[model samples]
Target: MSNGKKILIVEDDSAIAEIERDYLEIDGFEVQIVDNGPAGIERGASGEFNLILLDVMLPGADGFAVCRKLRETVDVPILMVTARQEDIDKIRGLGLGADDYIVKPFSPSELVARVKANLAQYERLRNRGGAPKDGSELKVGQIAIRPQSRRVYVRGEELTLKNKEYELLLFLVEHVDMVLSKETLYERIWGYDAIGDSATVAVHINRLRDKIEENPGDPKVIQTVWGAGYRFKA
Candidate 1:
């Protein structure tokens, strides 16, 4: 039943790493483990794996540093595994190009689900990017999204958007004028509601606004709906 999809697990904790690997393997994925960030970087950059499970606390370099470095050369989904439930840590990891996160003490099934979700979503994005050059280019206000190229532009200036940030923006634009709740956006973009955290949505929204809006402080395009959520104004 193996689908030929490979995964890399970067964790110093052998027990936890084994648990993750066991679950992913049960779901038919080929899994590899690296105990530290330095070795993680070398293996991750080789682009052999379809996804990576990165631990936050490591010896050589922290997960944040590893995620940042790996993102520089690897586009594969990087899911941070952390015991820290602090919002700042989540914000930092998401900001550093990690595709998603799985907290410690999480159910092995949930870990597998998170991995599957990130992988499924990543493949969808990759397929979209493989479309012909004539694929529809979305434009709203000064924002432009070229799905075929997997690029976004604001006011004629290209922007570098991490995976989740880009997906949130595109989803909002596609549903322009509709207020999407935090839970809704989280479930839609991150692929689950079980790990629902408003900070996840807030962080990515702020990131998108920072890249797309003329003034991120008081945004005009992607506006807050007071008690509702956010709406991309067309």
Candidate 2:
């Protein structure tokens, strides 16, 4: 599932981290283990890792704080590990920019799958949709996306987009006008839904609209289909 791609595991539990490392290394990924939140934040923001597996309960900073700090500058996929079964914890992690959450006691195979999925998604976005590219700019309504630079523009003005927001927009634009359900969008974009909730997708959609739409309150570019999902009208 990997080709020397580096993954940082920030877990205080040595056993869990070692198990994760062994599985990932066996899959051809380079693994780095950090036992604290501060170190994780430091290394994770260095732009050296393709993905990060962060634990919720950590010394120094905790997963939530580390995630929030990392999201300030890092766009890499963050998979949170938590033992809490509460919906609030999962929701908080998602809201804090975690790409996925794995509840503790998850099987090693499942963890590997989640890691592979997030890494693949990250690679797709980084590689400009992973197709042999023509370096073309995709235009939809007033928004423009330069595949080469992975940059987005709105009405001739550049707009900064977060990782998930950009991925969501690109996906919608590529399948423009197609009514995609939440489940489809979530799976295609997120790759995994440990919490089995689509709120993260909704959050990203709103964020994308806010960045690319003329007015987010009444979005025209990305239209919401009540009782369904969303469509890229633009």
Candidate 3:
């Protein structure tokens, strides 16, 4: 159903840009290439493409800046590419509103896979009628979630959440007051069996707490159940 979707590639390196464009085109995407961050920002603001493949290290402005600026204008999915493989960089990119990220020197196939996965997820969210039809907001005390817009608000202030963070939060909200194990949460939200790494749950929970809880160190909205998993409290 997503065949021939338009994708914009924003990369300063001509060779890398060409490779990405060729591979994306092969996968039935209409691809366009931009060599600088400013141009990419301009084109992105125009909302011409279904998706964007953005490079972190670009001439003029960096990828993070471009992502931030574009996010102010468009909700189109952005997949950030960078040579910096550090966890901080990945977190930073996601924090800046990128839907997903891939480190540079990555296999072309892997990049394409990420692109496909993101597009599929976006389409699912778009077509699933996830948002409210009446414009009535979903609230659990100070925490509010708008499924239609895929937005979370804490204490009336909108929280900036990445794709995975939003999904995890929504799952917790749907089952508020019920304890959900890490395994269950991962399998349900990730759509596969998990290895039961509580750390994965911990990171996302922490990220959510940073936005929803008054104090992440002493969380109240999403409370951790020792020896169990987590629960959302109204």
Candidate 4:
């Protein structure tokens, strides 16, 4: 039932990596394991896997660098694994293009759930076909959003966006000037059944600003409404 998807596990710890591989394989996914950061980057960029499970601490590059590098070449989903609980670390990981993150000491069930969720979401995007684009295409100033193709452009230059980042930007553009609360966006894009973390929304927003805005410190298109939420001022 997994649709024969391949997953890459990049972890320095053999035991942890084996555990994840076992669980994911049991769920019908093809899995590959690589230890440390350089190998992870090599396998990740090979285009052999549909998703990646990357650990934060590694011998060569660390999870952050792996995510950053992989993002530049690949558009697949990346889930960061780490023992750190600091918001800054999580934000940094998400900012670097990780689709989601799993804190260490987590249950195998939760691990599988996260992996499945990301894969499923990614599959939906891939299989969307020629299905109606809904908003189809949207243009706000120098930024252009093509929902059907899931592509974005700035001043005629195409920009790369992660799965959630594209979805967040599309949602904001669809709302168009309406203030969307963080909670509302979390539910709308991540779904009501999702893990429900507001920080996820914030991280994606920041990432979007970094890609589209001339000055990420002070954004123009995706604006914050103070305590209210975010708005896409067309």
Residue 38 Cα positional deviation in candidate 2, in Å, after optimal superposition: 1.0
lDDT of 4: 0.85
Question: lDDT of each structure?
Answer: 0.87, 0.86, 0.81, 0.85
Worst 10-residue lDDT window for candidate 2 reads 127-136
Q: Please give each candidate's TM-score.
A: 0.95, 0.86, 0.78, 0.85
Candidate 1 weakest ten by summed lDDT: 124-133
| Ten contiguous residues with the weakest lDDT in model 3 | 190-199
Candidate 2 Cα misplacement greater than 4 A, ranges? 129-136, 192-196
lDDT of 3 by residue, 41-153 (tens): 99989888899999999999999999999989887788889898577777777777776677778888888877876777666666655546886667888878888777778
RMSD of each candidate? 1.8, 2.8, 3.8, 2.8
Model 1 lDDT, full chain set = 0.87
What tens digits encode model 4's per-residue C-alpha lDDT throughout 20-86?
A: 9999989989999989899999999999898999999999899999999999998888989999989
Q: Write the per-residue lDDT of candidate 2 for residues 70-97, one digit (tens) a residue.
A: 9998888999999998878877887788
Mark the regions of model 4 whose C-alpha exceeds 4 Å error after superposition.
129-136, 140-142, 155-157, 191-194
Better of 1 and 4 by lDDT: 1
